[model samples]
Every structure is written in structure tokens, then in C-alpha cells.
Target chain A: MPGRGLNLTDLSYFPGCSLESSARESNISMMEAAEILGLNLIELEDWNCCGSSSANILDKEIAFSLAVRNLSLAPPDRPLMAMCPRCLYHLREAHQRLKEEPETLRAQERRWGRPISLGLSIIHFLEVLVRLGPARLQQGLVRNLNGLKFVPYYGCTLFRPPSLRQGSYYQGEMGNVLTMLGGVPLDKALTQRCCGSFLSAARADVVTPLVNEILASAVAAGAECLVTSCAMCQLNLEIRCTWEPRLPIFHFSEILALALGAQDYEGWFTRHLVDPRPLLQARELIP
Target chain B: MNPPAPALNLRGAASPIVLAEQDRYLARDIERLSRANLSRCFHCRSCGNGCPFIRGMDYPPNGIIRLVQYGLRRQALESHTIWICVGCHTCSVQCPMGIDIAAIMATLRRLALAEGAMIAETNILDFHREVLQSIKQYGRAHKLGIMLRYKARVRQWFADLDVGLRMLAKRKMDLKASRVKAIGEITRLFIPHWKR
Candidate 1:
């Protein structure tokens, strides 16, 4: 319903492991929202894992090589965009390392039998939205959020790491983008709290209290819900909280697509663990 | 319930840490590997205060730095602090000294694994192993498979069965893994030759 005649822009998208499997709703809604915004997110061919936190912990060599393999798969024409913050961090970190050590880059290129593009730009979906400007977003907006209050949760990986300090910081871009869509951003909450991450699987006891604290903060701030850019944060916050009247955790794209009046939202909303439909229905944004 | 134990007397006790047994190069090696300045940490405790999992860690982030600075190689490598960290970088961003505390923790974890130091938390290590195993086998993580293998390894099948079932009900965790067509490229990375 929005951006009916805008020229489409092509982007190479890396969904990573979480988005590809556990967070498929995020992937679908993100693609749907991008389509409305006239952004073509093409999947990279034969892409592998980003050598996640586990790989990075166990062996540095394997982690670097795994991330580099994805880099080799990305086409050099358009920028490579990722929805998952961890995947983006690993890819950019590997690229940074490769930039510093030309010999290692050459070795990786030789091993993969494909030339790794040193000039290829690695960007997040937030960066892409920011680059597209508020005017395009405003033009694409169909259903105004009707003053929906939400805590913009950027869980740990997007902009905190020291290795990524030199890169573009997207700390408040979520609030900025959501604000243009008539949503109220609640900044009083623990917006940058580390969402237990991989520890949720190994140590739920440690994660439960943390997730509860974050949700409690959002509740205390008078926020009706929480929006997060990372898929893992969405999953962790939804499943880890033991408190009653749990706040609905939304993937940033779901909210964005809903604003753009995407017709296939039922498919996406059905997959959410904490049902967001009640909140949407109450807001009168959806029927 | 018959006899009471006699009171023990303490006069002088030797400390467990002998200053002469310290590994002086421990700090330097960690700094080199992690590229973080260990000397910059003045025990500010900014990292520990901001750490979400500080309660889970035996020593605070700065305390681990203190252990490494003191050249307590065995203690530093064997401490629960390194294993408890999930590398969220909350400490790194909050550090006024520009020290990447998470990177230091990551380096310590690698060193601990390499030196065969006793892992403080075997369950966490087992989880990492399962995740890496899933990546190696399918090139992409299969959530169901990883969870099953991890639960099996930890020998706790019903630990988070509720959460697992909820995810299953929502179809969040797929039954089959999405595989990479060029699987050889991924499997090779797990081998030792890829390092060179």
C-alpha cells in the first residue's frame, strides 16, 4: 500500500542461522517490508554460518575462515546486509582482520577459490533504512502506529563491541525510524542491556533474572511492548521471562511491515511465541 | 553424636600463591592475543558494575584482569569469570580505560581450552561444542538438533522442556537443518589445515 512507484534497490542479504531457521518469521516480514520500501534483498548463494560465538570461543582460525567464506560468497556489486547483529559483527570483524593482514586475506581467497572483495561494504538493515532517509519511510508509511509505546531494544552486538567502534554506530536509529511511523520510543528502559545471548541455552537460571529485569524496566517505563533488531534478543526475551503479563517482543521488521500495511502479516504473527495480535488489535492497527 | 572435635590452633600459615612461581609472560601473551591493554585496567569496576551476568561470574571482569596482571596463569585460566562471559561487550563499552574486557575474557577462554585448564562450567562448554558440531555438520545451525545434542551431553533432558515445547509449538525450531550446498568448504574450516 506504500511506496507504489519508487524505484527498487538491490541488496545482498545474509539471513544468518537464526533468521534462516528459528526466526523465519523475522526473515519473511523483513523481506515483505523491504519489498514495500522497494528494496530487493537477494539471498547470497551457498552462504554458511558466521562462525558464531561458539566457534569464536573454541577456535579463532575456524571462526575467521567461516566468516570469510560468507564474504567470498557475497557479490561485490551491492552492499551485503544482515538482519542479525552477531552475523553482521562477525562478518565485519573478519573483514577488519582481513584488511589489516593482506597475507591472510590472500590465503583465504586462495582457499575459497574466489576473490574476496576488500571494497565490499557490509551494512545492517538499520543502516540501510537510515540511508534510505526518513522521507522514503514516511512516504511508505500506511498505518500510523497511533502513539504505540515501545522500548527500542538493541541487544549488545549492534554497536557496543570495541572492534566495531570505528564503524557506523546505530544506537538510536531504531527509535528515530520508529518515531517517524508515529510510534513513541521509550528510552527510560534498559535499551542496551545484554540479552543473556548463548548463555540462555546453557544457563537459563542466569538469563531468567536478566530478561525479567529488562521486561520490568520496559513495564515501569509505561511501554506496552518492546522492539528489538536482533532475532536472538527477540527469542531470549520471549522465552526467558517467567513474569506474568509478559510484554510482546517484536522483531523490528514486523512492526515496520505492519506500518506499511503488509497483507501477509498473519503468517508472520502466528509464528511469534508471545502473541502480538492482541496488542495490534487493541491498537486498532489490525483487524 | 558421641564425641566433640578438639579445637584447631593456627600460628603461621604459608600462602597458597608463591610469588616466585608466577608466570610473568601470562599477561603479555594475553595482551598480544586479545590486543587489549591489560595494564590500562586500574580496577575501576565499571565493567563488573555494568555486567548483567556478574552474579554468575566468580571474579568480576577487573578481578580477572587483576589475576592475569598478577601473573596467576593457572588461576586466570581456571577462573569461572572467563567461562561465564558471553562476550556481550557490555564491559568493553563501559570501560573508561578503552580496554576490551570481553576480548580479554575470550582470549582467556581460548587459553584455558588450549592449556587443558579445568573449565569452571562444563555445561556451557558442552553447549558451545554442540553448536559448533551443528555448524560443522550442516554449515548452518539446526536449533532442534543442537538443543537435543546439548541436552544429551549435559544429561538434563527436562531442564527447559517447557521453553523447548513452546518453541516447537510456535514452529520456531525447525525439524530439519538448512544445509549449505558447498558443504566441503564449511567442513574444511573445522580441520586443522585451514588454520595455516
Candidate 2:
């Protein structure tokens, strides 16, 4: 149970829709965090959507099939890890649906031209990191963000069609990891509130106010910065900042990487909407 | 092995809080709200702890769950709080509650709106639902379609132009395709979700 002593040798990783686009930080930082924790992420052999997108609103099968396809691609031994709530939602939800309805599973298998072995486990990156623990985390920090008030923005995936209770669950220790890394993890709200995931583009009108509500919490909590485990939530919260808190939103892993002593904050942290320089400058974590 | 019967603890109604006048312990439809299996919530506050909107709302998501458990029906339904819910539902995944706070929210939103709790500021939310419905109708969110409909109804019509340009420049918003290719074809392949 300790560190899962999990080998990085191979596994399928579902980075989610936004990871490739808006939330690249999760991707980059996860890489950094993985380095510190000694976990190797083998990108899945082949992948597609995790299914829970506005794209799936009209087509349920698109979301389910894509997730099934991704889950099916993982070799029998390695579990699949996903970073997006929606991806996790689709993949995990599909797993539950399949678990309950074997006939539905067979139909999809016949339709998609693939066989989904019912034995595979779908996991989240945050869950994996938590399982690995703070000892493994100690080796990951490049610099400790001592002064920044790191607030974790969880948003929708925390509760949804793919309920956390349903499958391989990840604990909310995402914030604990930040606090352990020598930063202030504010206990605040809207962490799991909606960041207007599907609404970001498809429904930008709803996105503004809903996202504003989340930002208001981070700002009011006196957080100098924010961190998140999900890629989509970060996208909404970062791009929609009004007063420009100038607080950089970080991927959970990136923060861990920084604390474990990673020197490349520029390459790692530079690509954010709300310039994290203020948080970094105030802390002297970087030159 | 026997599954844990859906648990219920409504003893709080004996107290004087008027919000508990109704059977608050029992959600209007517990079957739906409990889909995430909130019985699993250990109160670790992972979702609320991680929520970006933790400071603004009167009740964080976890508080809402506690409110639901206490049978504070009027309060939960009357909440302008859930109106601000952005539908992100991260608490569902992070939650040890494994509670689908998001789905509960979705149910709450329907109840809230039906019960008239969502009447505060119609501009943002109405347009938000409209956009989602448009995508639901078209199998994709055509940016131009979503934008025009949103602006026309909100009356500021074009006030969000700066945002559109920024997103487009960033490639976050697209102009060409109506839906992701093959979506309509695949959507019809699933089991029918019967509307009760």
C-alpha cells in the first residue's frame, strides 16, 4: 500500500480534452511531478475522448464509445489514469454502466469493433499521486512556494455522473500535498463548484458568472494563487479572471514539482493566463 | 453480500429551524441525487476544499449536502446559492462521498427553476441553458449560433465580443464545424435515455 511502489513502466493516461489545449499546465506539471515522485507515465497506445463533453450531449454513444475505446487500449496489467473530470466522468461512468449492464457492453463491443475487457481499472492522476504519499513528494519540489496562498479549484468532476464513490477513487489530498509543500492551502468553497466546464465555449454566457463566482472565492480567500487537479476547471477559472489577481493557477503536480526542487519554473510555470509572477515574486521562490 | 440500504437520518426536524418544516432528510427525489452515492461522503471537503468558488457562495457544495441531509428542503430549493453553481461537479470525483454533487446540483437546478428559485438574474443563466440546449439540439455548439442567441436574449447582445475574439485568437472557440464529425451518427447508437 505504501507508495503503491507503482512502477512507471507502462499504463494508459487520459489527459482529457482541455489538457491538450487550455490546460497544458496539468500535462507539463504532471510530467514534472511524475519525475519527482519517480512515476513513469506511458501515454496510452491509442486514445480518444473520455466521452463527457458538450459534444456528447447530443450523442451519448460518442462519449461512451470513445471512453470504452481508450479503456480497451490499455494493456491488461496497467491501470488507466485520467486528469480531466469529464474524461474521468465518461470513462468512469461508462465503467459503471458496463458493470451494471453487460448487454450494453456487448453491443458497444460489436459496434466499435473492439473488445473491452471488464477487468481494467480507470484512475485519476491526483488519486495516484495521493496513493504515492508525501515522502515520494518530498523528492519532487524544486522550490517551495512559501508565501503564495494556494487554493485548490476542484469544480464539477468532484460530483457528477461519474461519482467519485463509483470506481477507483482519489482522495481530496490534492490540497494536502500543496500544504505539505510549504504553501498555504486555504480551506475555501467553489473548489468543487462548477467552473462552467462544457459551458466555457458552448455556453460562454453562463460561463462568465459561474466562473466569476469561483474566482471570487479564490480572491476573497486572500489566495495569492490557485491550484487544481482538473484541466477544464483550470481553463475556466484562469481565462475568466476579472480583477486580474495575477495569481497563476497550477496543476497539482506542477506545484509538487516546484516544491521538490525543479529549477525550471519559467518553462514550467510561464504558460498561464493570469501571470503567476506576482505570486512567485512575493515569495522569492524564483529569482 | 447485502448492499447498504440507502441510509436516511431525518431527526433534525424536531428542532426549531423553519427550513426543516418539510422532510428535508429525504430529497424530493433521493434516487437521482444519490446517484453519486453521497452516502460515501466522509466530509473530507475535498470538493469544497478544491472548489475555486468556495469564497463567493453562501454555502459551499458540501454544506449543501449537509443541508440536504438535514431535510432543509425550502432552503436548498430556495437557494440562490445553487443558482451560482457552474455545473463543474469536481466534488463528485474528489469526494470520498463519491456523491454526485454535480448531478444533485443538476436535479437541484431543475427543482430550483421549476419552483422559481432561479429567477434572480436571468441574463447569464437563461442564456447559459439556452446555449446548452442549442448544442443538445444540434449535436454541437456552433459558436456563431451560441453567440448570436446569447447576445440577442441578454440585450447587451454584443458586449462579449472581446471575449470571443480572445478565445478565437487562442483557438479556444471555433468558427467552422457545427458538431464534431461523426457525433450525430454515434449519438443515435446508444440506449434511449427515457425522460420521466
Candidate 3:
């Protein structure tokens, strides 16, 4: 609840790998949204990758060491905010594990050449915004997305494995954000389904059907666009969606940025595989 | 014309079922490594039922757990299930016993790689290796470099080429690699863990 009291102005932000590369739109929009809401995001200096999904599967020790390195680098005074769900999950899980097993932390510290401690609370950006509450979000809203029907896709990492389950796992905060912005929030079952994740890179055949199911469900629910917080989910859904009547995938921050009257919204949409401008313009949510 | 009836065989072919002691050791090792408590699974099949990639798996999540319980190490480790698991954590979330089945899958993958077991899905493992190599080279992921290296290693140069082009056109893919300022520290962290 860092953003709840309005006293939380500055945050230590971990942009992770995807935010710097494929998910640049998410990074841009998130910064724009935060600026409008008067929140300061300080990027962690000399930070490395968070190990993501591949590192854990390949070697747990490496994953732990990597996350511990990142954790050690983060500023301890402010709460650490991770934009990517995978990074947040890995960092939080590693923090918990390292705290529980001091011996492991000691070993990692020996390897990393730095002392580590779980001083800062690692949180997702969505959680920070949610804790800020809808009323605070409403204060900056210039254009209400009245007719835009958005399906809030939580993906898997943000809300799974019991440790990371944020209350209901349906990403109600996304719904709350959309609702506060005067948009229709479709909190359907498919919104929380896995997007086949990294498998999209190796096995698209397996992922295509799953992605199709998610898209089909959103379309079936009469959704105009699919809003997700995860970068991998956005990539998989947009790239694998080859079927007819494709739905534009929007990072939740993009919508939030638009609602806050960001003028260069078209720049963000240009990077998306499926352009969302048509839907937004049709509803006059964007010019 | 009617098809001729097949003749019945007089004797059935028999195969030996040997329970190796090594299987028990392997099961114990997996249990120790994952800390998943294989005995806690009661064939509920909740993990299998909830698994999104069950259809692609040679053995379902419950079946893999059952294999672990019975100490069928060869069968469990060689299964396509471990390779196919995307680590979505659905099985772990839905497990009534609160077992982190995905963690077990990760252990199985490591064991499989260590034992040089025949991987049913080679591309997935290859992709993982390429991604790790990219992380090792650059502190952050370079999308273009990763994809190019992965394609070259997997020898599927043409695969997803169209999507790659589209991403490039859309400015979604970064051509240049970005390295963290403290890459030496990152390399130091990986060297010891990877050496083992």
C-alpha cells in the first residue's frame, strides 16, 4: 500500500529485459502514466537480468544468484517496483527463499561478491497503482473510455503458485483501473489463462491453439481490446493471433496513459503487432 | 468382399520388468531437489486436469507424480511432460496438497539434462540453452541476437522469419544489444554456478 497515502512519490523501478527490448511500449506508457499521476520511478543503476523462466528451469542456483544480485543493487529506502510479472515473481520468490535460507544467501553472496538482504518490499507496478486506489486514478482522468470494452488478461506469473496470488488472481485491479477510466472491464475466466509463455518461442504450434482460445474467449465476450500487464502475454497473443477478427492487445499502462491525456499515444500503438488505434479512435478514446 | 479374419496367436510375448535400485535413489534425489513431497499426491489429477499443455505431454502431471512415488525414475525423467511444461504454475496453484509441481518439473528437466536422457522435445531445451547463453553474453536480453542465435543453433532459420520481420518493421525488436554497466559482476555470479 505504498501509493495509498499519496506520500509515496519515488519508487525504485526494475524495467527488466522485456521492457528494454520487445516491451518498450509498456515502458513508455508506464512512465507517461506515472508522470501524470505524479509518481517518480527511479531506474535501478547497474541492474542485470532477473533470470526469467529459463534460468530457473536450467539452474535454480543461477536464478537465485541472479535475483540476489539484482536485489542487492536496488535502493533500500524505497519499495522496488518491477514492471514485468516474471521479474517480480522471480525477485519476490528469490527474496523469500534467500530470507528463509540464510546459508543459501551466504553462498550467493560469496559468488556475487556483494552482501544481500531483503530490505525493500518487491512489488508489481499494478499492485502499486491498485493500492493508490481508483479515486486517486480518477483525479487525473481527462478522457473517459466510455464505450471501450477491455478484457483484463492477468496471464500466469502475477497470480499463481499461491505465493504470488494477489487476492483473487483475476487481476481485479486492472478491472478497477479500466472501470475508473469509464471503460467496460470484462473479467472473464479466459482473462487469467496462461498465454503459453516462452513456449511461444520454441513451440508455436502448441501456443497457437492456446492463444486462439484466449482471443476467441475475448471476442466471444464482446471485447474491443485485450488489456494485459505481462509483456510475454502481450507478445504471444499479438504474434500468434493470425485468425480472423483479431483483437488488439494493449498493455494496461497504455490505456492508463491515454486516459491521463497522453498526446503521443500513436507512438506506442505503432510498436504493437496488431494496431489498436482503430478501436481507440472509433470510440474517440484516442485521436 | 469381406475381409479375412486374423489368426489368434498361441503364445504371448513376455517382457522382463526389472526394478532397478538406482530408480529409488533417483526418486529420492528428485524429492530432495524439488522438495515437492511426492508422497503427498493422492492421484487427485487436479494438476493434470488444470494443465494447459497436458495434451502435448507424454505423461500428465499426476502420472509424473505417480511415477515419482513408485520410483520409476527412467520413465519419469525421460517423459516429454517435463520438457513441455511452460512453467505456468497452474498445477502448483490448483494442487489440493499445495505441491509446487512446476518446481518438480524444473528438477526433472535438470535431471534429464544431467543424465543425458533422450529429450522428447529437443527444440524447447535448445531454446532454453540459447536464451541462457544470451543472458550470459549480455546483461540484458538482446531480442535480435537471441533469435538469430537460437535460429542458427536450432537450424530452423526460416521458422518465424515473417514474425521477426514484422517485429523489426514495427520497431519491436532491438537490433543492438544493451549491456548493464556492472556486467563483470553479472559474469562473476554466473561463472561459479554454471561451472558446476
Alpha carbon lDDT of each predicted model: 0.89, 0.62, 0.82
Model 3 segments more than 4 A misplaced: A1-7, A107-115, A165-170, B1-17, B20-22, B193-196
| Each prediction's TM-score versus the true structure | 0.94, 0.65, 0.92
Residue B10 CA displacement from its true place in model 2, Å: 26
Candidate 3 lDDT over residue span B135-185, tens digit each: 788877787888888898889989898999999999888888878877777
Q: Kindly list the per-residue Cα lDDT of model 3 for residues A37-98, writing each as its tens digit.
A: 98999998878889877877787777777788888887677788998989988888888888
Candidate with better TM-score, 1 vs 2: 1
Q: List the residue pairs that clash in candidate 3.
A: none
Tens-digit lDDT string for candidate 2 (A27-99)? 7777766766777787775354455444343344555665676666677577777777667767777777787
- As a whole number from 0 to 100, the lDDT of residue A68 in candidate 3 is 81
DockQ class, candidate 3: medium
User: What is the DockQ score of candidate 3, to 2 decimals?
Assistant: 0.64
True contacts kept of 1: 0.91
